[model samples]
Target: MLELRGLGKRYTVHDREVVALADVDLVLKPGSFTVVVGRSGCGKSTLLRLLAGLTLPTTGAIHHNGGRPKVGCVFQEPRLMPWLTVAGNVGFGLVGKVTKAEIEARVEAALALVGLSDFRNAYPDQLSGGMASRVGLARALVLEPELLLLDEPFAALDAFTRRGLQGELTDIWLARRPTVVFVTHDVEEAVLLADEVLHMDGGRIIGRREVPLPRPRDATDREFVALRRAILDDLSGRAGSSPPPA
Candidate 1:
């Protein structure tokens, strides 16, 4: 499990300190899927960065149940190298730590997992937006991390593509059971994907609501619609009542 104790982050811009995250506390249990939803600049991405140890917090601690866990991340953009093939990008981090054969095996398995085995030899410039995103996901999976972090990984895809990828993500999560934390601004997407949805605003987690509706959820269903409205109201400071625990 991962625990955050009064975790906070701030930055200095032109001599003034700006708070990106403030007094934020959260606990992420193993094998659980949690999604953070908020408007832009609400510190959703910042929280993911802090959890991945890519950045330090200003005034809090992130505690793991045991030793530090292995982390993998897929960012909003696919940060692949222009010179490398899809396979190379997927296995990019394995150099010096594993043999070429091992990297090749892992890369192949990851590509298969993301349904991109046929695109292994293609260059980033040659693939479509969704295909490139798959390459990014494959790269993160190749590391076999215990904790996976995604920052709007599907925000750029077209609606049809986004739905397809979301389904694939759900399938992969159930199979691998990795602790997943996804950050997004889409209310329907958050409610559809996460076991718990957190609302962040003003650099702090303002509310959290558990999504107990059945999996493979339909966005148009009455229960799903109700949850979406409630989350929207909560985020806008109009939810009225405090949400129950997850």
Candidate 2:
């Protein structure tokens, strides 16, 4: 569904050039959920922005097959309008394209999908942090996006809230099945949410690991333990942390 060939990005600030990404190549298949995991300043978010066309690569190309795919992005914050109600925020993206009736229907459906149907009329300030984040997700889902780009969308929530939203997100993905490229610094969250994990470092992809474990994954399982260790080693810049499962 998405392809990046020789992808690279660089910025010039005050006459000094900084490379954010370099010679990176990746392919994303239709409906696949892939997570890019790396420490801060590792270019993970830059990659997502490139895919989202929010920024252009300095030295490479991103190609989507045939027709341009619809995209929805969820940033670290809810980014909802302070004055807009929940339904208003979710339907905000549909303006000019969809009819008022269609927009209302989409907003209501997305709200229900994210377990926020009861709070449809609540304002952003009235909602808790987690509830506000769900509003962000609902706004994205209302677009019926073919590709969903999430940049640590749950990083700010409390642990329990994060976990709850993670499960909710998984169920939503399983049902809607959008092509997802999620970027996160949390290894466990990436492992639990993605079908494949890509470890990035120094503006390049260092490793690709497939998570074979079943959904509703057990965090305490032995296999999960091994995988976690391997990912930790990779992020820590260890050499050949562990061989890929044979």
Q: Candidate 1, which segments miss by more than 4 Å at Cα? A: 239-246
Off by over 4 Å in 2: 243-246
- The residue-by-residue lDDT of candidate 2 on 1-246, one tens digit each, is 788899999999899998899999888998999999998999999999988889989998988888668999999998999889999999999999989999989888899888889999889999999999999998998999999999999999999999999999999999989999999999999888889999888899978899888998877889998888889988887897776443
TM-score for each candidate, following the candidate numbering: 0.97, 0.96
Q: Which digits, one per residue and each the tens of the lDDT, describe model 1 over residues 66-159?
A: 7888888999998899999999999998878899999999999999999999989999999999999999998998999899999999999999
Could you tell me which 10 consecutive residues in candidate 1 have the lowest summed lDDT? 237-246
For candidate 2, list the clashing residue pairs, or say none.
none
Q: What is the lDDT of residue 232 in candidate 2?
A: 90
RMSD of 2: 1.4
TM-score between candidate 1 and the true structure: 0.97
RMSD of each: 1.2, 1.4
106: Cα error in model 1, Å: 1.1
